[model samples]
Target: MICFFLFTGCEQVSKSIKDTFQPKVDTIAVEKQQIPDPVPYDAAVERQIEDAQRLVETVLEKHTKAHVQYIEGKNTDFLTNEKKLNRAEEALKKLPQYLGKEIFIYSSIHFYNEGKIRVMLQHPQNPEYIDNYVYENETWSDPEQLSVKDNIRSRLISLQKISFTNVAKAASVYNEKIKQIEGAEPITGIYISVWDNNLRWSPASINGSRERYSIELNQNGTLKKFERE
Candidate 1:
């Protein structure tokens, strides 16, 4: 499911970028060349996956720097830049396979602010989630209620279990509880969900509403950091 969310709806995005960027170039002497045929879905998915990985690496570096600046209580515009968003969309266009594939790997950044980086990820077919935040105060939140030390441990265990069966069971029970809880705020943050093809990265339903999980990062290019639980 996580894989589907990350890989689907990319073709439309790529086409939009091509259309938006095509008009800005000098055309006086340039002859129109035949654009190559669109690549196969598999190929496009692979390219997008690579790009997303690269973006993660870049964010990791910048996030590390942002951590320090945030600690010093200094102003930094590390996370709100347009270039990073552009790069993120560009990378999303190249992701090939979803996380439930034999070698599915998931990593994403949803938002960055107040010296906090929110990360959402699922490894392979693992059902357990890694949802957490790193704050400028060097504090962290296990949004999933996972302990830092046991986070990956649970994920590793999930990979060996039967798919969806257990998750579905959990969801059935959780959903009932969700319905009973009442609140005006919409459930907007990430949680476990069955939205993707393989039931990966299942974001929980909030206030009877399901939300897409987001990973946020904060940095100033000099100090980097992150949080995953």
Candidate 2:
């Protein structure tokens, strides 16, 4: 040990000071925890969701009887590594309560955008009626089961994939979106949808009589879209 003293002798230093320069080695073997892959995010999903909301506004203007049930998609917030699925589970669970009895509900809107949008209100007791009125833009197709085409059959197949969806990591990602809107109000209705391998949902407050913000995410928790409806 080297020491510089103004006057005099060698004295004993504290044990903590000595340990600071010399660390003790451990003999135990420890296992490291494996981490999961990080979730992905894209601003495009948010934009698309927003666009869907705008369309809902136009749709409501012409048809006063219609309402935006819910909007769903997959998107992520890189900062928190969150799926940004905001209030998804809450909205999803609200749907079953809306369609209590088994009844085939018709589709009034079709998404011209990249992703698909399907609506269903069925005999709350049966699954067969869910595909009855499901259709594409301006063209109504019968429900079929196979092939990955854009027909109602493929849509049914997509809906069946929701069995693999998980919302254990859900959080509030719509707060900012709601605040960003011009005239958002208290939310009244929520809609849930199963699209292929994605689980879409939203926490929406009505902007007057229309929805202000909603978000969607894939089954893997990747955010697909965020918009107003």
**lDDT (0 to 1) per candidate:** 0.36, 0.36
Model 1: how far is 126 from its true place, Å? 2.8
| Model 2 TM-score, 2 decimals | 0.25
TM-score: which candidate is best?
2
lDDT at 128, model 2: 36
Q: Candidate 1's residue-wise lDDT over 1-229, tens digit each?
A: 8777666667778878988987565564354454566666786557655754554454456445543333233323323434443444333223352323432222433333233334444522345544333333333343332222222322222222222123223333334444555542322222222122223332322332333222221111111221222
TM-score per prediction, in order, is 0.20, 0.25
- Candidate 1 lDDT: 0.36
What are the per-residue Cα lDDT tens digits for candidate 2 across 114-220? 12223433334544343322222323344322111122222232322332123322223333454566665423233344344233554423253344445665444
